[model samples]
Target: TIFLDEIGELTNSAQVKLLRILETKEFFRVGGTTPLISDFRLIAATNRDLKESVLNGKFRADLYFRIAGTSIYIPPLRERPKDIPVLAYKFMMELAQSKGVSFGGFSDDALSLMMAYHWPGNVRELKNFVEKALLLSEGRVIRARDISSYFEEHSEFGRSLPTKFDSSVPSQLIFDNLQKIWEELKAIKMKLSEIETEKKLSSGSETLNIEETEKKLITSALEKTKGNKVQAAKFLGFSTKTLYRKMKKYGLR
Candidate 1:
């Protein structure tokens, strides 16, 4: 069978059999050697530093030589943030169908947060994130807060999960804290409060533009959740649509 994962991760024993097969169209499984013979190709992948692992003796030299014949490296997710939205949408659609929860899709702002993510964990991570997103999505949109749990779970790494949904934390203070975070950023805040009052800019020509304002909010939300806007929005108790509207109002686009 053609392997889709990193070649270096292949077991040393498997490598031995593979090498033998390449040299003499014959091989054996983990056990039972009826001289299984076949003509097949090999493929593997991984994010680990294989060459360094080789020097450190974590990988086999001979096996490396065998698979090295057709090595192909895939770039990490950070270098391709543009692909985040497409992948997230695809995964979300599949997840929704599986769960029978069709909430449409990610709002443009939510997608932006996804794109900004560094994705150190790579595409597999992107898949998990999208699946988990459907779990806490609000209405027709996935907000920054809805994604917080995923990040929290990932950051744990066998250790205790970080504090999330701290019910003891007061609501007003949370909103104020989120607002302070937005105001502290280099951009403007998003959100419209038809509180029967709109502040008129004295200069009107160059008030903090909408895009810049909303960016600050999105950035704050993403940062608070470790680049997970879904959870951030949920924590803030705002629908992803509300967050998006605010983002648009403030020019976070």
Candidate 2:
């Protein structure tokens, strides 16, 4: 049997060669003329959407059909919150045994925070967090504070904001503050427009200050939400796509 990971990343020439081999089940040795018959099972996997790649001309339709006998789509970690504790413990135990640490398990609060997290980087990120927490945690159980810094760092929010969202705070108050910030931003834009009209000059420093304020708000939202982009967007009074575009514009991640 042959297993190919990321088969969609095959070059065009390589795809042609693979297609020929799959069709004939035969190939000549590199330095030989005689064709050799080979039979084997093939399994392939990729994180990319193969059909989309085919549409984009990046993947060959024939080759994709050849290997796509069966396919499985595993949702990302954030989509399956229940799996977080299971995978987190699995990683924790494996890492603890490797490092010869006598750790008991994760605290309930720790697990809760993790479940609420968005985990943008998926399983690998989870494993990394578990390992780091195990190393940092002093007690038998890993507490929320043990792994809280990981979210802040991975969220790429440079400023020190609240470690987690304050659930006790009224949602209406949060929205009111967000609305006020939005209004302030609009006022700044209007001021900048008036200045441009009167002086016929671009206020570079004022524009820089506005950008800095926007970045801070976005960062604070992500930190408070524990890296959950959807929640952060709502907190900032932005559509999810707009938040993503703004994050990209500011090179936040």
Candidate 3:
């Protein structure tokens, strides 16, 4: 089997050669005349929208069909916030091994901040940020304090809110802007829910339960705040009452 990452970037000439190989299941050596026949499976991945590329004449329609045997859509990191901790740990451990250090994992508040942020650069950005955090960390565990500066430096997450409301701007316009942001958040959440359902059906594993993930987040927040439920709830963007209710539901202390 052969795996081609970013196959959408293939040039026209390269695509022609690949298509021929797929069609005939044979190819000649660089300088040999004998045709070499071998059976192999092809798996191609691309971040680009291949269908749109095909319509725009950027990718060949016949080549697209030949390689597109099965397609799986993996949502971006921000949409699947539950996967953040897992991937963070994976990256942290790998980095720690290379540095000859122990992997202490991420503190709850740190993980919470990560889950809340919209990763514009996706997993690669997350990995790079994790490396920075690990390097600057004074201890084994990566606490919120350890990486908070990096987040602020690289993103607008912890930036100050507007001190004064703009009276000149119409209230309705402000409301409409808020509504659009809310709708976008809702859409992302819906996509995550759909992906969770698909994962359960295909893998027969209940690994992506949003409720379970929420429970873990709440537990982490509480731990980070050191039993200050009010602060934890505030940090989590939840009302104290809601936080209490979730703690009760999850049998959290």
Candidate 4:
């Protein structure tokens, strides 16, 4: 697969060239007359709306039609609130394992803060935050302290309120604050229940044998590093020789 990110950023000349290649299934190297036939599936992605770009005359219509053979629209993180905790745990697990740390996962308050915040930077920002938190975390679970730094530095949601409130604050204001607190608590409880269910399901009825778990982890590390055994070995905290031995034992060679 040939993946072109930010397809909308391509220049008009580049777009025309791409269109020609897509039409003729061939391309020419710079300063070379020979046309080279290319046979590969194309997958292009862009945050910009290609249709709008085409209408605005910023993107080539024919090129857009050729590249957008199939399109998938993925909503931003804040739009799909339920996925926050799921993706958080997934990143936590993958990162923790790769770093050779044993993380139990995020605290309820930490997860709540993440869910409440509007992720303008989306999943990439969330992944960076998780990785940073993993490095800074001092315990099994990632608490609000580990995550607050990123939000405070980058998001308005992390700003603090005034130090003091009026002593004569209205009763309605107090009631509203209480109601919001109650709702947050309820949401936390629901998230906790979901995490518990996930943990139980992941643990399964019967635990895998040590060898099985080891092989699985090795395979996962290999896949994550795109079959780079040395990187996978380092990720698993094993020497290259030890990794090779394990792979041979598991018939992974």
Best by lDDT: 3
Give stretches of model 4 more than 4 Å off: 157-253
Tell me the TM-score of each prediction against the true structure: 0.54, 0.55, 0.57, 0.61
User: On lDDT, who's better, 3 or 4?
Assistant: 3
Clash number for each model: 29, 0, 0, 0
lDDT of 3 by residue, 1-253 (tens): 9999889999999999999999999999999999999899988888789999999999999999887888998776766665676677657645755665433456667877887777767788999988878776633457788777766776774233222344897979877865663443344334445555675799976445445545655666677679899988875567999889989998998
Candidate 3 local accuracy as lDDT?
0.72
- Candidates sorted on TM-score, descending: 4, 3, 2, 1
Instruction: Give the per-residue Cα lDDT of candidate 4 at 10.
Output: 97
Residue range with the least summed lDDT across 10 consecutive positions in model 3? 157-166
Candidate 4 per-residue lDDT, tens place, 1-253, comes to 7999888999999899888988899988889899899898998888789999999999999898888778999876776555677676557656755776544457768977887777777788888888877777742467787778777776774333222334797969876865664454344334434444555588852322335445656776687679999998876667999899999999996
Question: Which ranges of candidate 3 are over 4 A from the true structure?
Answer: 31-33, 156-253
Q: What do the candidate models score in CA lDDT, each in turn?
A: 0.58, 0.70, 0.72, 0.71
Tens digits of lDDT, candidate 1, 120-169: 67788888877766675532357666665555555545233222344787
Worst 10 residues of 2 by lDDT: 204-213
lDDT score for residue 31 of model 3:
95
